[model samples]
Target: MIVSLAISGYRSLRNLILPLGRLTVVTGANGSGKSSLYRSIRLLADVAQGRAISSLAREGGLTSTLWAGPEIISRAMKQGEVPVQGGARRSSVSLKLGFADEDYGYAIDLGLPQSDSTSYFNYDPEIKVESLWAGEALSRHNQIAGRSGPSVKVLDSHGHRVPVLQTLASFDSMMTHAADPKDALELLVMRERMRSWRFYDHLRTDREAPARVPRIGTRTPVLSSDGADLAAALRTIQEIGDPVQLEEAIDDAFPGARIEITVTDGLFEVLMHQSGLLRPLRASELSDGTLRYLLLIAVLLTPRPPPLLVLNEPETSLHPRLLDPLARLVTQTAERTQIILVTHAQTLASQLSGCEGCLHFELRKELGETVVDGVEPPRWAWPKR
Candidate 1:
């Protein structure tokens, strides 16, 4: 479970630290940086998978995503006494993202690459610093493993400094390249846990959406991010997972509606059995909202839950009346996994906040920066470049 999350110089999320709970609901107005926060978390997960540089590149490079505000927002600037402007930069160009979990913490820093005349991928960001530490907060004594540019260091079992990698690549993460099992035991463990972080953002439910079309069957313990294997996943849950919860979730949302899977020649198709209907409706015939609700159920009640589950705007096509059921489903799912729900629906936020062991945050923009409402931000220290 992540106890805290910190982001700096990422879109409107300049210098933001947020506390997390078993079920964390983050809500805000449009352009209040909710999507930016979600993207930042995905970027942190990408780092552990050795895809951080490529992920940033796909987002149009670091320069495009970095904070465009002045390096420092002065008090006068907030009061409109002085116009916002950038002068000399007091710190290095860095976009930092990190989180502190139950027993460990991890942070990574990305910066513009040095002028590389020989490489065509000059716009790619360079990994400047990375750190893995013990406890909820990082400190000098708790620093277990870290990377400074190309040099990677780890604390051995006897607490002696051990050099793991001498010439790590600029675009590669130490989590992937230097996490030796023997020398960097903690680093390896942290990397695997980070890899288990799952994200579901706006699953496609349109007529041509993959989830609506029939696909080959497979033993799917976990639903795909695109929900292409929705039938197999639901079937897996019905067989090995908690079928009672599955049936209850469906009925809770659609009253007497239940789900059925039909497999023919290895192709799996989803069928719905609802009250007051002679014939069942196929996935392709269901409304967009209904399909999306089923996708959410398949994800939240998985037989094999990830260490972390992030849902972005799950209330997208859901009706207002269904928000309460969705909220209840999410809260129930939190018993087995940590969840972070980014949404724009006030009703859903309110419903989630009413749940036990849930944290609610309303984000607002202050001087063009995203700030959590009426809460003191967590204390954070970034690893120096």
Candidate 2:
């Protein structure tokens, strides 16, 4: 499980370190940088998939996502004695992200690309440094792999640095290019673990949502990010997964209601069997809240649970009455997987207040930077460029 998360120079994150538990609930007012923190985690996962550069470009590149505030918010500025303003940068322009579990830690540094006349993608950021180390904290003695600029190196059996590559692209990640099952087995293991992380944000339940359309039947152990395979996912659970838990989750949300899947011409569709109804309701006929709730059920009860699962604003469009059931489902899922829930609903947070292995954080903005009070930040170290 990830014990700590560190992000710097990313939007409102500025320099933030957050401790994590088995079930971490991050709650805060709007504009308190909740979404930024969520996206930073996604960015880290993208690195393992070799999509980090493209993901940053899709978010309007480094300039748009970098912190806009001053390098230092001085005491005089906080006292209102002087206006907050930027000064000559004392360091290079860089954005850093990292996370650490009990066994290992990883960090990456991204900076502005060097001036090049041969390329036009100047807005694209270059990865300056990457490090993978042992234990929860990074130290030179525990470093297993290190990359500087275009060169990559790994530790040998004698704990000596062995050069692996001299031409690794700046847009690529060592997690993808330098991992060797023979020489760098640790990199391969860590890479796959990071790739197993899953994220869900703003699942659509509109009239044209994909979940409403019938799709070909296939055995699905994992729900797609868009929930396009909702029927297959639910059917998989009923077949090989914990069917009792799925049914209980449904009944807990809507008393006496259950789920059914119908197939016609090899196309599968979801149907809801509820009390006091003449017939079951099709996925397209169900209300937005009902469909969204069902999607969450399919996600949380996945047969193949990921190492990490992140849900952003899952309470959206959910009724107040359903918050308790949702909280119960989340806590149950956390037993098998690590979960990070970012929510704006105090009711949901209250429901999970005293659950086992649960940690709660309330974020707020201070001088345009996100801050969390009353909890000690976890020990973390970032790889230098």
Candidate 3:
């Protein structure tokens, strides 16, 4: 489990440190940078997969995503722009993100590339620094794996340097590259951990959404990002996973309404049995709220839970009455894996906070920077360069 997370120079999240728990809820106003914090976590995961650049490109270029605030501040400068403001950058333009897990921690630093004349991918950010330490939750102690630009090195189990030094490409991550498997064991472990960090953001329930359409059945232990195979996922859970929890969750949400997945020929479909209905309704015929609620169920109660699960804006289409059921479901699911819910709904946040075990972080903007409410500065020490 991730105990603490730190992000700097990413969007409006300038130097923000947040403590995590079994279930962490992040709530704030529209522009308080809740979404930015969520995406930064996603990007940190991307970095370990060597897809950090791809993820940043998808968000926009790195320059556009970096913080836009002034490099330094002063009392008079706070009032107005200083005349002698040289605009000299104090530190290297770096967007750093990392998290401290149970026994290890990992951090990555990305910066703008040196002016490349011929390369068309000049806008791409380059990995400047990456580190994975053993247990320095308070200080920079054991150096398990460390990288500086192209030069990469690793520490053996005995905390000694490996014989074979390695070189990594500017565009690639030390986690992806590096020769000799045993040399970078921590990096490899960190990479796999990051890849296991699952993210679900706004699963659609529109008229033409894939969750409402029929798809081929298969043994789906995990739901897809688009949630197109909702039936197969739920059916797989009922067959191999905890079917009682699945049924009870559904019944808890809709009273007597239970879910059943049907497979005709090769296509998979969903039949929702609700009370007072003459006949069970199909997935395509069910209301948007019902389909979305099932999707949430399918996501939370997975047979194979990831190391961390992130749900963004899950309360978008859910009715106010269903919030309690959803909150109950999430609180129950937290027993299996770590969860971070980034939401805009105060009611859902409040309800989840009132749950048995949940750590809530209310984000607020202070001088254009996002900070957790009532958190003392430097309460959580970050892994620094």
TM-scores for every candidate against the unseen true structure = 0.98, 0.98, 0.94
Q: Rank candidates by lDDT, best first.
A: 2, 1, 3
User: lDDT values of the candidates?
Assistant: 0.92, 0.94, 0.83
* Tens digit of per-residue lDDT, candidate 3, span 1-385: 8888889899998788777889999988889998898899999888867789999999898999998887655667646656424387878888988888888887888899998798899999998887778763545567677778787777777767653435577778877776246567667777888899999996889999898888898999899988898999999999899999999999889999887788888999999888899899998898888889899999999999999999999887878899888988999899889999999888889988976568899888756778776765434454444
- What tens digits encode model 2's per-residue C-alpha lDDT throughout 1-385? 9999999999999999988999999999999999999999999999999999999989999999999999999999988899999899898899999999989899999999998989888889999999999998888689999999999999988889899989999998999999999888889999999999999996889999999999997999998889899999999999999999999999999999999999999999999999999999999999989999999999999999999999999999988999999999999999999999999999999888689889999999989999999989887888777
The per-residue C-alpha lDDT of model 1 at residue 136 equals 86
Query: How much does candidate 3 score in TM-score?
Result: 0.94
The weakest ten consecutive residues by lDDT in model 2 span: 376-385
Q: List candidate 1 segments past 4 Å from native.
A: none
Per-model RMSD to reference: 1.0, 0.9, 2.3
Worst 10 residues of 3 by lDDT: 376-385
